[model samples]
Target chain A: MPQLSTFYHTLLRGRAGLLTGAALLLGSLLSGCDLIEFSPNETRTPEAYSDLTRKNLERLRQQPNPSGGDTVRFVFVGDSQRFYEEAEAFTQSVNQQRNVAFVAISGDISDFGLIREMRWVHDRLKKLNVPYLTVIGNHDLVANGREAYQKVYGPLNYSFEYGHTRFVLVDTNGREYGFNGRVPDVPWVQQALASPGPGISRQVVMSHVPPHDLDFDPQLVSPYVQALSTAPRVAFELNGHKHDFSIGQPYENGLTFINSYSFEKRQYVVLTLWGEKEFKLDTVQY
Target chain B: MRRALLLPLLLLASLLPAAAQSAASAATPDTLSLALAAAPAAEPEPAEPAAAVAPTGLTAQPWYRPHHLILQTAAGQGLITAGVGYTTLRGRVDIDVLAGYVPSKYSITPMGIFTAKAAYSPWTLPVAQGRWQLRPFSVGGFVSHTASSGLNNSRDGKYEKGYYWWSSRTRVGGFVGGKVSRVIGRNRYGHPRTLGAYYELGTNDLYLSSIFTNLGGLGVHEILTLGFGVKFDL
Candidate 1:
């Protein structure tokens, strides 16, 4: 007995109510997933030592240093491909040669610095009968990356002297948390270069990101360039970030810098320190 | 009393002769066959009134009839996008805004959007009902836009800050599908309802494309929901 107008109004109201309810439910369901969004870690965690990290570093340090120094030739390579088996094969092949002193991986030891990559790299590097050293790369800074790097590779900015040559490795990834600076810890390199070991005849700096690479931090380049020019024992600088073979000769002051490319040539540089002030660059093919 | 009885008997006797004559004629071979045929024919003629009744089925309506609207949100590579869209038999149109986060300088401040886009579908098909009321297949077409925003940086060495708005994100695509529907209605106080399965493909909404892009490519996917309380004109 309802009037025609009343029936239409009731039907429309019911339809609208149902539609509005559906919209509300859809909105909530969609927005709920959005609420669980991912935010990049803003605060950087200081790389502190841990049991596993310390154990890994000690394992690397424990590898035997050869007794006699008869023209010690170490391979300086960086940015190994992602395949662990390929890298392990390369390491084993290099290990078979008896004259090689030690292997110094410039940086990007692990593409992501994930525990898996670090472990894989470590296990593969263990195949070598010689000692191996690594520097930190940009990819190693995600999540607990620095901690993982220091745990697996040791003090990232530390120096080591082997058979008259002093090698200074530093963290060049900078604070990529979108900080105000251009690059990271330049002063550390300056001090490291200023003080080489007692009988260290040659000094060389190695890092993942090259100072001359287009993707490099401009601010960090000047101070690093200054350190390279002033250091008396400094020979040629070795670097690998460009992923391709490139050489730059920056005539800043009096430093003749040689910026090496990536693992393209299956190659690394062999520096022969010819006593206190002179050295020779021999690009070794592995 | 005797005279009245006699009058009634006289009337009955007079009517009995005519009745007897009609019965005799009906029982004759030729007359009986004709009478039987006439009776059946008369009965069947009354059935003609049924011819005016309307056939019970769905109406021949256009396929563009849309029954729902959808919104999508996607964020990736330091960018976030929010979109609102309307779908109908005619077509669809959507507006989207993108925003980026700047965590270094401040937590709350967004670097703003590097890109923003708005898309409009000029023509759409009523492919939903094609697989249902008609055969099991339908097709449709739509033209759309997909713009990009340029990037900006505040300082030479630091984080970039700027926005780029793209003009031409236009594209065209088609969809083909089948739809099936079922109506549920209780006669008590409400109208009937419809529910069923439907699939559409084409140059779809940008949000769907973005999700598919994030997933690698557009393949098979599902967005299931229940619809009730629909109205129609007879």
Candidate 2:
């Protein structure tokens, strides 16, 4: 009986050793495999995926031969939510165009606002021949979408100037915040519009939720629209949440608001600007 | 707030591995099955008397008694999750229900998920003098409903039908893995109680769809997550 007990103990110890080995391997494998996700909205991304705004800006800034900072032609599009097939077509269409300097998306980068959806859009948009940037959208603010958008695209409200144009990307999705009255950051927009660098000829504001839409905070609409209308060298405001193509002055204050079609529409607009308060809009179908 | 949400999960995790609860349950199972019973290894044969005692006619347990309790992390279910399951079909199939938690960050609120899982294991090898089992392959799937804000299953009346597609609250995922268990002695309820550790590689419907659409770019591993946990007979 003693011998049998000893043999059983030996077997248990051996099995324990094997289990330990397997556990160790599993530990290492967990780290190596990207599949071990903690949550769908989890915020772990590689260096290349994070701080994308800085990366894209760096790419834009490091161009060697400079243009005369005068005529700027760029692709303006929006609401690229979960339209992979359309995104591919959009990219192909944009690449074929001549003299397009970068691209702008109005918002709604992801439908459910999951990190996976943002990454999918980014992965597809990354294929564009020219550098592209986006503003935060209502859909992008869903769940942990605000964080995911900020992490992946940089800031909800940020601005950069290239070729006599100061592109100010603002967060205008007030309804996402239950109309807390602080969104659209009127003060920030006024300031950015107030101070365009020397020789800048135009300013274009872009956001997902347009001021005219009910989603925009009604209380702050006057202040927001006023800032844009009064801003220096204001050309036109671009938006994307409508998923349709519309170009008009919603407030009829001589301030133009251009809404880009969603990727599913298989059409995008190319805006060409040459002088202060002067622009041309062209739509391309993919 | 985050700490408060996770406090219960941490407590459950700490209470799962102790096998003494299982031992005490052999005498009175009512408390063991209902309470957070951290069971100890059931040693069927007395160490010194090895082959001497072969007790007869152990009482059979009610069919509804849980076969095991599971505590797992990741697998896209939660940062920490716990569940109870019943094993059937010659102990090769399991059906479980898990409650999982996810911590909040930024604008996203912390959420809890309810998951129903079923697994089928085709082969189990008995080793260690018939006191242990090694299941090399376990295949299963789960339907999890995320009880979180903003993951809406239906759109408001303002939007047209199919305005926004895809179900946000419900998710279907599948996993494949292996388990190693140690057999304990029979309980008074006439059932073999075993303690096991398992690991699974899993992916959800959305991830799988992404893989299928972008097969050239995405790898099977990119969409998969690992779920490891302890399982014990109740």
DockQ scores for all the models shown? 0.02, 0.28
A20-125 in candidate 1: lDDT tens per residue? 2443344345533311211221111223212333443465456454435423466667776344444655676677665567777777765433333455456567
- lDDT, candidate 1, equals 0.45
Q: Least accurate stretch of 10 residues (summed lDDT) in model 2 chain A?
A: A11-20
Deviating ranges (above 4 Å) for candidate 1: A1-71, A175-179, A259-265, A277-286, B1-234
CAPRI tier for the interface of model 2: acceptable
**Candidate 1 lDDT over residue span B45-109, tens digit each:** 12222322321111212222112212222122122322212223322332222223333321122
Model 2 clash count equals 9
lDDT of 2 by residue, B1-234 (tens): 343345446435534543445556555545433322322343435334333232221122333344577877778778778877767676778888787877775225667777789999999888766677889999999988776664433354434467556565677989899999766544444445566789888888877776676555555655667877777666
**Model 1: what is its DockQ?**
0.02
Q: Report the number of clashing residue pairs per model.
A: 13, 9
